[model samples]
Target: MILYYALLIIDPSLIGIFINPFIVQFTIFTRVYFIACLLGVLIPGILFAIRSIKSDKPEINLQGKLLLIAFISFTIGALLTSSIPQMTIKVIARLILVTSSLEFYMGYLLPNWVKKILLKNDN
Candidate 1:
């Protein structure tokens, strides 16, 4: 999911300044975007990372936003990322959608389609 969002967030204003003046107050926006990306990476690992955080205590499993956590992990896991806030948001949104689509496909549609095909052949 995070991978989906990160890829979707390509820089739109790279063509030319005249073509797109969307970049304003460049420094602050850039920082926020960086933070968002960092969050994307950290949110996931931190969740599962606790499985071994305390050796003496029982494992504490996490249960929450699957996609959001995945996206955070994806963005953080990336080796490099652009500082563009808008672009980062684009990627994050897309990642969430893609993750949901994948969940749907895997849990319901894929199995049903396969079963339907087999049943049709039997008929």
Candidate 2:
């Protein structure tokens, strides 16, 4: 978890800005949109970590405002970017979002079928 958040911090600040020169050329609106996307990932990760560290329990209602913000940011970023590489990165980011969101869901949401599969021995 620490590694994940560390990457989140590092990616946008150090790697994204430095590695992608076009990012520096982006308008302020675009910059804010990207920042919002980063916040989307970071906020949920922070909340999940805090809740886990405190009680080792899952948090229901995992899909909240942050996830929606992340989704919208990604959509806008993809639409605005003309570069194929940037578009590819957005695609990868989307995959990461889905994977992490699934982690949150399975951990906290506990839908009945998933619970049955995970707790087959429990009555």
Candidate that scores best on lDDT: 2
lDDT of 1 by residue, 1-123 (tens): 454344446652322232244333234444466667577656654554444333343212112233334444455433222333365654665565566555334322335554454333433
* Lowest lDDT 10-residue stretch of candidate 2: 56-65
Model 1 lDDT-worst window of ten: 57-66
Candidate 2 error regions (>4 Å)? 1-26, 56-84, 116-123
lDDT string, candidate 2, 1-123, tens digits: 454456557664432343465433443444565666667766665665455546532223333333444444444444445233464665665565565556555554556776555443433
Total clashing pairs for each candidate: 7, 0
The deviation in Å at residue 60 for candidate 1 is 6.3
TM-score of each: 0.25, 0.37
The global Cα lDDT (0 to 1) of model 2 is 0.49
